[model samples]
Target: MNKDIRITFRVTPEDYERIKTKADQAHMSVSAYVRAAALRHKVVVVEGLKEQTHEFKGIGRSLNQLTILAHEGRVSVVDLDSVFSALEKNYIGLCELAEQERR
Candidate 1:
């Protein structure tokens, strides 16, 4: 989409500061943040999601290593039902959190 159009509005100093702070928190530019807000877009900022993502990456690495070991016959691969269940639970939790924030 070509966003060549521009829109301008004035706000009180306190409102400007609040909007700037929210934009910073959302890691978006002021224009983008304002545009999203004006468009009634849900801007969810879930805390610790980054850390959770990092942990998921680490789990993926460990799973990859386990797969490699199993392929080499160096280790026996057992059922991963529990692991998958936990991952799914966490995923659902995150989704619910985002939904709650949207509300």
Candidate 2:
């Protein structure tokens, strides 16, 4: 979008601070955050999600390494019931968090 137009509004200092805090949590600029809010967009702030994503990547790397080792006959494949359970739990937690934000 061109975004050639400008809109201005005034808020109390306290309101401004609250909006800024929310924007920071959402990792968006004030203008973008306000625009999304004005447009009724769903702006979700999922705390700790970035750390969880990094953990997931690490798990993926470990699984890939394990697969390679098994293929090379260097290590025997082990049960993955616990691993799957943990992943499922994390996924469900995230989903619940999102649902809470929507409400």
Candidate 3:
């Protein structure tokens, strides 16, 4: 096994406050949060993202309904345009969020 090494650094007061705030929100120690951030790890807290969660669940329900209709052989008879439109909008929103995360 390898021994862990220490990395010490300094930041401006404002930067420190920003890091501390993010660490507090992530429920991680300052060191761990900084380390993960430096490593580019995706550490998202879904509890603070209820709107995205709700949108995702709504899209999931729409997809489930479509699945049920297909399984019951009723897809051709039902008007599915609105359901598909909602799913597309939610999917685009999610894609935009993902793009923002990459930056």
Q: Estimate each model's TM-score.
A: 0.48, 0.51, 0.41
Local distance difference test, each candidate: 0.84, 0.85, 0.80
Query: Best candidate per lDDT, number?
Result: 2
RMSD of each: 12.9, 12.8, 13.9
Say which prediction, candidate 1 or candidate 2, comes out ahead on TM-score: 2
Model 2 regions lying over 4 Å from their true place:
1-43
Clashing pairs in 3: none
Instruction: Give the per-residue Cα lDDT of candidate 3 at 85.
Output: 83
For candidate 3, which ten residues in a row score worst on lDDT? 41-50
Off by over 4 Å in 1: 1-44
Q: Against the true structure, candidate 3 has what lDDT?
A: 0.80
What tens digits encode model 1's per-residue C-alpha lDDT throughout 1-103?
Answer: 9989887889999999999999999999999898889889655678867866876787788789889999999998578897798688778877876777668
For candidate 1, what is the TM-score?
A: 0.48
Range of the 10 consecutive residues with the lowest summed lDDT in candidate 1? 41-50
- Winning model by TM-score: 2
Q: Which should have the higher lDDT, number 1 or number 3?
A: 1
Q: Candidate 2, residues 29-69: lDDT per residue as tens digits?
A: 99999988988965567887776677678778878988999
Off by over 4 Å in 3: 1-42, 45-49, 62-76
Superposed by TM-score, candidate 2 places the C-alpha of residue 59 at a distance from the truth, in angstroms, of: 1.8
Candidate 1: the clashing residue pairs are none
